[model samples]
Target: MIAALVSAGAAVPVAPPGLHWSACASGLPQECATVSVPIDYAEPRGDRLDLAISRIRTAKPELRRGVLVIIPGGPGGSGLNRPSTYVKKLPQSVLDRYDLVSFDPRGVGASSPVSCELAPADVTQTAILPWPGPGGDISPTVAWSRRAAAACAKNGGPVYDSINTRNEARDLDAIRRALGERQISYWGVSYGTYVGAVHATMFPGSTDRVVLDSNDDPDPALVERGWAASYAIGVEDRFPDFAAWAAEHEEQYHLGTDVRGAYLRLADRLDRAPLPWPGANPPVLDGNTLRSNVLNGLYSDARFPQLASLMSAALAGGPLPPTTAAPEAALQNTFAVLNATICHDVSWPRDLRAYARDVAADRKAHPLTAGMPRNVYTCAFSPGPAEPPVRVTPDGPPNVLLVQNLRDPATPYRKALNLKRALGDRARMVTVDAGGHGSYLDNGNACGDAEVTRFLTDGTRRDITCRG
Candidate 1:
């Protein structure tokens, strides 16, 4: 039966030959290799690109089960070094049973990276993410979106157009073939979860135990647009966690007992009179900047102090926190891939008035986000997708497990429900009673970790909520 399943309609590519293992340049214990894949899967014999891959073989060959791929977050995230980083965190049972593998998706990291050649100003995190100006005005965001769209289209070429989630899945399949594995298991986080879901849907027969952690909404109509807007819901869901922490440390932060009110008041005050932050990307700390920082800080409990410190400094009108800017080349690569993938994967609404209306409503409904979630993106100005978004459905096998934090700031629990509903009985979800992004091995949630570990090692399946 397993043989029949493996032979039936599975897209095991023959083009990518077996990988030649060599010590990674990172000086880690893992081995690295490159897989040659077509830029356009439809034209397999056409222009090709190289994908960087890394893996750590299980020391206990006797306990070996199969290969487990680590799919990283950020449409532009690089997983080439994940095998090395995660080796210490993953349970010994998992390490002994599976060879941990990862890769830099095409257009990311060492895999023929693409750049939009955007200006340093445009490459800033605030610029790339489409945050609105003061008073929920999206005119600046609109202008930036149009300029960025043109720049990327002019510079990205065919390679940019080819970088979508579907192709990424095809790349994963190619990796599976190169490893000579009939079935590959994976642990996908954030945007990687969407990639994993699409892969499972597109090539169910080739997948083994699938673990989608910190999932995204798999809404076909609003693929990445939905993800962009999810921040509004996610932030609201996770802010109370931050608020409670701030309330506990009120004497240090001095934001008063009403921490939430203090946050809102300070954000509005900064909006009216921005603080000049020298050496910063935009060189100013405003309402949106405060909100963005809070959103980022809510990703983990350890980051609460950082967010609190920034708030305390900002509220006191004292010296502002120093900004740590990323390298220009890295930012260019990330923003380019982010734009290329999101824009090419699905179509976004091009109407400016529509965005204005949504932003206005969203700003009123969720002031903490300041309408950024409903604002315009480069996709609004870019060309339509070559193909429709892949629909994640329950047509696949029931070997998938989804582990989620109840209050994930980036991928909210409410939206993750959409993905869970889409998967139907094909998946069993483990919702952690936590207030951060990642679950399973992360957040120190022993219950969630044990569940995921057992599933990966012995194919155990159970749907239970874990208290963090």
Candidate 2:
């Protein structure tokens, strides 16, 4: 089956400019394109935005099942470039059965961007997201949140306000309609899982086989809040992996011979006196910056080395790793969109007192994450408010399959379980014994991957469990 796909001239079409296609990465001939989607679905005839989309067509077009859309994580991450990156990881039989498709959500990647136009200082990792103090003092965080919110309000425009998961789901339906497909199959990872869920709920009849990996907590009452709180459990789950890695490299990264001791010492030192980060906007490695780096590093196991290197350098009284400034255009646009979607999805309390109370409680519960999870930010800074929130009930077909890692640092398994339960009889779940943000073709176990592939290719799913 794999050999046939290689010879199917799948690589004939050149991916659109800014989009690259490579058979080496996807393990098959791949092509890319840009699909223009409406920024606002309510006004399908309104201003348009280009979504960078990619595809790996089935070897036997006649036997092709249908388009299998791969949704990327981050609410801010791009799937537009995923077909080439993920195709190689899928089973050959799956690749031979359907055309794989992915796209950059609006305001991300090469898609139409919406920026906050924040000051360079505001864009710094520490300043962008407020992480409270070790002792739980949130005064600094409160001030930072206000400033960040103000900057976004002053700069972000309509485009930023327009980006949200509902609209993105609507955009996916539009893509299906454009492709002339009455129904489409889907595979979404991390935040993408949420996208798939929303799509399934909104257009139940328009979906075929569906897979949601590393799912999110779909509490309509607290969308982003739930995601943020999960970080505490997620980090606790994934820390073992990092600990083992650090322990194995004790000679090289001598923060401590034991992982726990090493992590504690590093945290203590950063809290006491941060290193000067030359050329960084703030020119310093504050506690919040350290926290951000830790959170970002935990996204994948492959990044453990980077964390070790940073810890070793900091402990040795050396310069921290070089800080790369986020592209002003990308950060502003991405942040604006992320905030718009999160804030618009639900009504966050305007009471600063309530936020302070939550921050205090969170600080006590999860010291490593500080009180950052509960810190408040204003989403009203965007031009338009979120459209009326649609309650996502599982009215879809029973064709959805959910795959999840037991310990994902970004979207934890517990949260994924919540989503699975919400789907009721509309879906079945495969819990992979793994640790990371994405499953299928990435951090998933063979059993889980095989199950999803079989379901996608032959429409068969397994009722099983996996253990690490």
lDDT of 1 by residue, 1-468 (tens): 322465432224344447898999989889999999999999999999999999998999877877899997899999999999999999899999899999999999999999989866677767877778888889999888888889998999778889999999999988898888778899999999999999998888889889999999999999899998999999899989888888899888877788778888999999898888777667788887787788889999999998899889998885887877778898898998999989989999988999999999999998878888899998888998898999998886788999999999999998998998999988999989998888877799899999999999888887899985
Cα lDDT for residue 443, candidate 2: 64
lDDT of 2 by residue, 1-468 (tens): 212222212122222234344443334456666677776777889988877667877777766767788887776776766777767777777777778888778887667766767666666556556576666676766665666677767766656667777888888887776555667888887778888888888878777788888889887777776887778788878878788878888888885657756665667677788888776556777666767777788777788889888878877777787866666666666666677677766666677777789888876677667777777665423233456555667665677888888878878887777887788777888888877777777764677778887888777765567665
Highest lDDT model number: 1
Off by over 4 Å in 1: 1-17
Give the lDDT of residue 327 in candidate 1.
81
Q: Rate the local accuracy (lDDT) of all candidates.
A: 0.88, 0.73
lDDT for residue 431 in candidate 2, whole number 0-100: 86
Model 2, global lDDT: 0.73
The clash count of every prediction, one per candidate, is 0, 6
lDDT of 1 at 331: 86
Could you tell me how far off, in angstroms, the CA of residue 56 lies in candidate 2 after the best superposition?
2.8
True-vs-predicted CA distance for residue 340, candidate 1, Å: 0.9
Per-model TM-score on C-alpha atoms: 0.96, 0.87
